[model samples]
Target: MDVRSSHPLGQHSGSEETGNEEPEQSVQRQSIIPSRMEDVICRLKDEVGYKKSFDVVVREMTLGDTRTAFFMMNGLAKDIALTEVLKRLSYLHGENMTSDALHSFMNLYVPAVQVEPEEDWNKMMTNVLAGSTAMFIEGENRALIIDAKSFPARGPEEPSLERVVRGSRDGFVETLMVNVSLVRRRLRDPRARYEVVRVGERTQTDVCIAYIDDIADMELVESIRDKIKAVHIDGLPLADKQLEEATVRLGWSPFPLVRYSERPDVVASHLLEGNVAVFVDTTPSVMILPTTFFDLVQHVEENRQTPFIGTYLRWVRFLGILVSMFLLPLWFLYVLQPQLLPPNLSFIGPSKEGKIPLVLQFLLAEFGVDLMRMAAVHTPSPLATAMSLVSAILVGDIAVKSGLFINEVILYMAVSAIGMFATPSYELGLANRIVRLVLIVSVAIFKVPGFIVGITAILLLLCFQRSFNRPYLWPFIPFDAKALLNIIFRMPVLESKTRPNLLRPQQRDKMPTGNGRS
Candidate 1:
């Protein structure tokens, strides 16, 4: 087999033979063709590029004058450890050595390592790229790949999104090893299982689905695995995107079927409830499968607060969603048909003196609000708040004074904006905004009845949507009393002892405590 080093040319200089030398002679006799290390280095340099330094060292050795060679690729090998191992192995020079002896030497000398012998060149290259050190001998058809991966890694840090007043601060990182460590560190139970799969044909991204083996339904886990396996995309930019595409029963549905979060505590809570969590390398977010509408609205922080406060917050969020979905459309309806509203609410109708079309007024206000939001988001942090204030005051004041839009329209848009903020997930919040537009148009055409019909259709669509055969509006639409309490009002941690039955979880119990007995 032709052998080459994955290093740069001229990085290391060794004696070159004028004609067929001992190493070359041995190569011909045993069919061990040696390509110049320079050729391999050139290929690596051409493929990976020259931005980063690539170094190689080649040293000639004679084990009982049998003629052998040692090659090391720098920056790829673990510092000091590989060098020390090489130093120890050098002592075997000028001693009669066989393939078995060399294998034995590597096995006994290497620390916490495994050697995979492969004759296929392609497989050897793949292993090398995956952080293994490949060793080829003069007469052997197979090459030994040693596991000496020591890439620089950063430890997990406190979560930014799912920050909790109580519970663990540790969160998953872009690294898969660190993420698995975080889960193992927290659960520490033997039942916790992680199944790793490679996706992204070109990128070959590592994705792992983790759940408690005994507690997680095997069928549910397999379903998740199959769905993920079915994904044939080039790369998954984030775990959420993959989950969105793979887990949703209806891709067109506005509601999110999978929940993506950065907090490990939130993931831990979901796993305990028999939800499957998927972690992808290079992304901080972990995707929770078979998520219901209630899951999107619920916050882990709410669980840390008092039950009463949590329930109140949930109601507030619900009201916010209602307002977000209807406010603008209702305003448009009030303008189009003042007689349909109750007497007390009739004041919302357009002023008799106003000449501009109500539709145009709403469109203008919506544009103004959106522009302000975009400005705030795109500006630098230090200037963002100031820009928001400037844009809000300028747009509201100018549009009202110029008679281009009404004050009431501005008020309704502001309310809708506030409602949009109430949504916990940014994706879900944006979806609400889109649905609100459709609802508003319906209400404008047919009044309150149209708005009601639009809402009913949305709810119906949601009920029809599923995540891995589990209802998207589970526990709420089905009216599961226990799940409803846990969904709408944050149930005490101890009382919430079972996973959602809608998912058909294998394990029914969450805690060991039975019937509230000690």
Candidate 2:
């Protein structure tokens, strides 16, 4: 009916308007739930399974002489809060509760945090299923929605992928509120906003768009909101990744357009830089939009160290990423075209040809590495290390020694795998693996031309890849020397003043200066 767009972490703009019916028609049409309480109960039995499901609890009680029922899922609504609510409502001793008494009860009696009214079945069902307690009163035109949601979640722990040696160990947990609180705990800015949007027709998943109102680009924020609203998925069982596919629309691109972080400090840092954080419910990882190539390549460990050490770390990481992408391709070239290598470097190519051709060797090696990676993921934690060691030592050594794979092939493949493991983003690493395989195949087929063409094609693709309409290559393709240098080197926090120019943030100043614009 009435819909609006407002700031995040605040009251919503309104129920997002779908435009199926007029605002007046929304109230006039009682298609799903009837106006009468008894009819509503009957509909719940037939539609919402009030009796058939054991977990669905409908607690009927007399409220101020009015027949009332509280509907909530068993595990979602907290027992203590529900008990408190029922106890307080039992104190009502007057005649049937008028509309005014119901309003008073919602305002004064219910100590639970969130309370709202709903009439439509669509909105009511969404709230009821998403851990909120729904209350229906006899003779009332609307039903009460009390926020009594509780989720099974673990305490924040260090992220397995993005762990820092010297920074805060507390990372985001599965709970949306806890994750938001983690960010708010670090970022106390008054302008910091977290706008909530519910996606998924069946799941009714809550996705929060977080940014600083003054510093973030309004267009960027609006773009994310509009795209999220357009997501017509029935459910987002995969959570953030599913939402990413819907919004980013990154069709066929192996590279990640959005950066994901489980660390709160990492999220707060991104928000301050004018990037919006898209938080999906039931997920610990938050997605940072308008990310560049450098964002995925970077790790928080660099920032945790001193400036000089941080710069060294950043450079080392960049080198590792480069090696992961190109080392195998270059090796393939050297093996085929030994004349291209200098006398000193000519020794780099494989000395002995194995039973399999170099091309097949590279392909099989790629498959083996990926197979081990997938196996490590599914393997138990205690055995993962041992399994990896056995696979690397026994399997790799035996393959090479038995002439199944040449010694040089095994060595180079192991080196490439090491570089891949050193990469900060697992998604990016996997993408690099695919690209590496492509390069190997190309070099194997066309030798010199394939090597050149493969590199050029990848560069063109990176240049074309857009992150929320911003250049994914950023300072490289568009060429901002200063920004590019900053991405390569970790500068002290105090030295960094201007927000990313690419974002076109409303407020350029990070420090309190006269606009602080460069």
Query: Each candidate's TM vs. the true structure?
Result: 0.80, 0.92
Question: Model 2, stretches more than 4 Å misplaced?
Answer: 1-28, 31-35, 95-99, 514-518
Report the lDDT tens digits of candidate 2 across residue range 385-484.
Answer: 9998999999998998898899888878888888899999889998999899989989988999999999999999999999999999888979999898
Can you give the lDDT of residue 174 in candidate 2? 88
Best by lDDT: 2
Q: Write the per-residue lDDT of candidate 1 for residues 1-518, one digit (tens) a residue.
A: 22322221212223224553456434333322234444444544554453354454344554433344443455555656666656666666444355564465456544435766655545455556555666655555555667776655656777755566776677777777777777776677777889988776666677899988767788889888987788887766665576457545455767776788877777786787778898887777888877877788777778777888877877888899879877788767766777778988766765653457776666666666677777777899999878877787876787678877667777788899899887787778878887887777777677778888998998888888877787777787777988787767777767777667876767686666674311
- Judged by lDDT against the true structure, how good is candidate 1? 0.69
